[model samples]
Target: MEGNMNYFEIFKDVSVVFFIAIPPWLALRKYLKNYLNRAFLTIFFITYIIATLLTQNVFPFILVVLCFYFAIKMKDNFEVLYYLRPIKEKKTEIILYCLFFRFIIYIINVFYASLLEYVGIKVKAQDIYEIFLNAGWIKVIFLFAMTVVFAPIVEEFTFRHILYRGLSKKIGKQLSAALTSFLFALIHYNLAGFVSFFGIGIYNCYLYEKYGYRAAVVNHFIFNFISVLLILLIKIFNIPTVMT
Candidate 1:
């Protein structure tokens, strides 16, 4: 399996219509006090569709930021910040817990990648890392900012905070977790790693429900950071993979 496949193509697929459609729908529903009225909902949906089509590249990012802002503002409890408030006694234990679970997910991802190859799919393990590695320093900085920081804030707030919270109201926590995880995996648009992505999505949801939103965000950041670091080492040293 060659590992130099174009990952951006994953984002450009027709299925992207669904992923791109979700933010505005969910975000508007959060702010719309009259969301329960079918007529208003229909009208607003149409308006949002038109607006999204007409907007520029930065609009979606701006909408994500606004959603992040409102998600925090509307929460009755400040769980986003308060969840990780340190307890001197449990601090070490918390660190261990994150490390342990992150390690578990890493194993799961590697196994999942192998499983994909076993099933005849070629897995490009370094697609995203190569983007980081090959880009200029300034572009790499922006990529890091967009992925590790802005993306986590936007995605965690959207999927874990807003969507998960909204769904939990209508469904069981277990079902909500699974559904949210499924959607999260779907949006990534990478069939080869779908199972692995779903696993991490569920893990993040567990952290969100058990600890708080901040825990999910931190876990996401740590996962991406470790992934990039590992890939950077691999690229620099030309480490052999199963594909190689």
Candidate 2:
């Protein structure tokens, strides 16, 4: 039988709006399928949505950071972090492996930037298809919130926490991680990103397998920040610092 094609093929029919219901659907499927579980999942979804929307500002960020801090502080007794279990042990080997991969991808990004320039897209450090350039402070901040804050939480939860866990239940750990990482890369929905983030997904899965969600979050946050900083340096200072 013919299998499903690439990520884009599987997702071409999926609209952006479909994602709005993802959290609830996921909670239902993963945590609450039975009557009791379903009831809890429904409430959890509602609460998660409300909390995220209501605390879209610094408050939410503060709360999340504090949670991370508490987890670090309480270390052994952090029950909540257990919710993101199967997190891998901290290991330098994988971080170094990811670092080497990222460095190569940085060169790829620069070349990709050259291609974008060919087609009249400005390949700066930051620009969404080079269409939404740094218009102003307000717009920049909005982009930051969407890409950094909202995206990391939601995407990691869905792609890694839920899907990774689901797949791990049925397959070998290594195989499930590879497949989930591939799906995560595919769902990004762009040729450039499709080329770029697959390895990132792999690294994230490695982190999940090693240090858990906290490591994933930390790696993710650092990756974004470094990318942004590199872009800004490239565009504003005319310096080309590659991804580390």
Candidate 3:
């Protein structure tokens, strides 16, 4: 019975990603190169309605829509898709910088967790981690794709590339980085993770400024890959540990 329930939960999660997430994402990517047209808008609204009906939590969809909206506005001036360019050089430097940022993020998480615990607030694993805790191997692999691959690309493009560059034009780099970092932390909807996310966001903004779009994406990818690897190890070894 428990096994059956786990399968059902996995099916539901996969359905949400397939039905609620992928179509709109693909549409946005397709239409992003060209000017905003009727076909793209139609598909977006259709997906929005379907997503809303499928899940009460429509915040993430709305957030993505907003990012794309801004992205379209900035398309004429900026190469909005420049983040997708291949990073052909500085492979070793990017990896080293990613490791440095990952260490800093870990420290931020530890400090935040300690502060919360001091105030009698327990820091628990994020929802994704909880899903991993109960998920079978198939579900774990699916989640690995979502977390380590899909999420880093979408998020780095949205937050570090589009949002950061747009804001930098109006505000100074420092202020823009701070605001973007706050928004990035806010979107996670996890209070326990806010500080860590904010720290990483700031680091990503620094990378975007110093190294350019692909470097920031690489850093984000490395960050998420480590977390997924840790989860895999825990599940394989049946190790007891707190994710947060």
Candidate 4:
């Protein structure tokens, strides 16, 4: 077990991980010129970790500014925003398909939750929940922005569009999806909801492959939105099972 540490301690550990990983990535930039940008990634990680620690009180504002900054910078290479543009065709079909996928994923999550409970694997909510649960309105708003807005955009780009796309080029899509899904679950740093997150990750990858990155983003938003709603409902209804 690890001892308790302050934010800077954790940031130090995170920096080390990036430091160790960055060199090989930098070396491969020549080969991966089109796919990867070492500078953007380096800056992104630095901003992400520091912004997370420093801007708790002004998270939404900082994130909004950063989002626009990235959008401008990524205009040409904006694979992240490409799918988010307005759709010309199959709009209705795509939405209906996404709604259906959400339902399917929900059912899978239920079963996956049950399985985790059966095996006695603890299912922990993501840490951000505790952070914003009883905080003031600003914090609540920040949580919403983080979960429903920024998380969907950043995570979908990183896990689905970027990582899965790159990996699928080497391995087949199936293997890539599996690997990316596991990484997605792993990054959330929760053991209990691992299966649930993995299921959603694969589902998002499927949406990205079949429909578009935008579809995956919408699906991701819906998932997180629903989770937020559930948390709200639990608090409102005082659900005993989850309360303890």
Candidate 5:
């Protein structure tokens, strides 16, 4: 039964990847003909694959930095940095909204874990969390940088600025946001956290549409910063609990 369940989980993940990723690619194939769009997508997927295959926690940080460097070199072609400007107004509002969403994500995580436990299945800590728990202080700081700074930049540029924008042009914005959110959640490959990620993805899309890409990026940074703080607290206190 355990083996069967593993197979089922694998099947579900593959199905999600196919349904969420392939259809959008097909729809946006022509749109991606633009050099900047194609390049950004390529960078995003390559980094994603490398980050997945390489178990070392620091690789993600390195890959994202490389991605950002390439993006900077191409700034003249796409004005990429314009979207990365810090949010100058309504800082408090953005922070509050992020905190609210973080709370909702926590509730969703707890409910999912409880449901899995009720079914006699133990919930596993997310891979990044495990990395944090096991790593030395120096490595943990690198992981924190990846989480709080670099990840948000690369992920927002790819998902919100590239994917969401391209998909919006092909489909309507509403459907585009939904599809982008679905792909964002699947890319993380955390079944137990899918709903929470999806919810945040939707919120990020909304921020992008309403306030431009900077808002989305800031939202992601705040969300991750809070998560990293909690993880640091856990490590400092030697908490026995695992977070999904």
Candidate 6:
């Protein structure tokens, strides 16, 4: 295993990933222009990582809530979700169907979790639980916003609207969706969350393919809401599980 990195890893390693990746990304930008803005992504990654580490205690919650507020407002007025799908589907139908897909994903996650445990994929449940102990109301509220609002808007825009639509033109949709999902999961920096989040990516892709951004966003929201709620519920209720 690689040695665990310190704050320098967040600072320098993150910079290296982009600085090295930039030239090829720019060269390919002519092809995948709409997929990612090179400048914005580099800025976003750098700013986000540094800010995330620095703002760890509580203030970041305030910023995330702001992101949620703006996302909801834009989605309501601009109809960004409507434009990204097939020619005829209504946003209402897309959201409902997406929830249906989200329910299915929850079942899949449970089964996969069992399989991982059976094979002795040891993960420190207590470590994750401690993050919750540090969490106060601000963090809880932020978790809700992160799940039910912010994630839906950002992830659907990233994976469904941008990643899938851009890549499918070159590779087939099948390969593009799978690869994008894998990459998406890999970026989250959690060993235990990889499978469940990858499952999220696949389900989000399906929602996008079947309907549009509306469907994808709705599914993403449902998945996050459920996951966050479960974690909160376990801790809140003081259930005697391995988590703490």
Q: Which residue runs does candidate 5 get wrong by more than 4 Å?
A: 1-86
Off by over 4 Å in 4: 1-49, 52-85, 241-244
Q: Over the stretch 182-213, how does candidate 6's per-residue lDDT look in tens digits?
A: 87776555656676678778877876776666
- What are the models' TM-scores? 0.68, 0.58, 0.73, 0.69, 0.68, 0.64
Candidate 4 on 68-158: residue-level lDDT in tens?
A: 3555565735554564455557667776776677677667766777788799876666676665556676768777886787667666766
Clashing pairs in 2: 32-37, 87-212, 88-209, 88-210, 88-211, 89-210, 125-231
Candidate numbers sorted by lDDT from highest down: 3, 5, 1, 4, 6, 2
lDDT of 2 by residue, 1-244 (tens): 2455656434543433234234334443432343356577678656655655543323334334444454455563444466455435544654565566667776776677578879986533322423223345576666566566655655665667667767788997778888877877665555555546776777778777667775676566556666655544554564544322
Q: In candidate 1, which residue pairs clash?
A: none
Residue 175 Cα positional deviation in candidate 2, in Å, after optimal superposition: 2.2
For model 4, give the RMSD to the true fold. Answer: 6.3
Question: Alpha-carbon error at 197 in model 3, in Å?
Answer: 0.5
Instruction: State residue 143's C-alpha deviation in candidate 5, in Å.
Output: 0.8
lDDT tens digits by residue: candidate 1, 1-244:
2333445544444333345546645665656653367787788667655554553213445666555555556662565445433344644565577778778876777787888879998877445566766777687767666666656656776678777877887997789989989998877766666776787788888877777766777777776776666755765676865321
Where does candidate 4 clash, by residue pair? 122-192, 123-192
Q: Runs in model 2 with CA error above 4 Å?
A: 1-21, 28-80, 83-101, 108-134, 234-244
Residue 104 lDDT (model 5):
83
The TM-score leader among the candidates is 3
lDDT score at residue 102, model 4, on the 0-100 scale: 68
* Span of ten consecutive residues with least summed lDDT in model 4: 19-28
Candidate 6, TM-score vs. the true structure?
Answer: 0.64
lDDT of 1: 0.65
Q: Write down the lDDT that model 6 would get.
A: 0.59
Order the candidate numbers by TM-score, best to worst: 3, 4, 5, 1, 6, 2
Tell me the spans in candidate 1 whose CA falls farther than 4 Å from its real position: 1-93, 238-244
Worst 10 residues of 2 by lDDT: 123-132
CA lDDT scores, all candidates in order: 0.65, 0.57, 0.72, 0.64, 0.70, 0.59
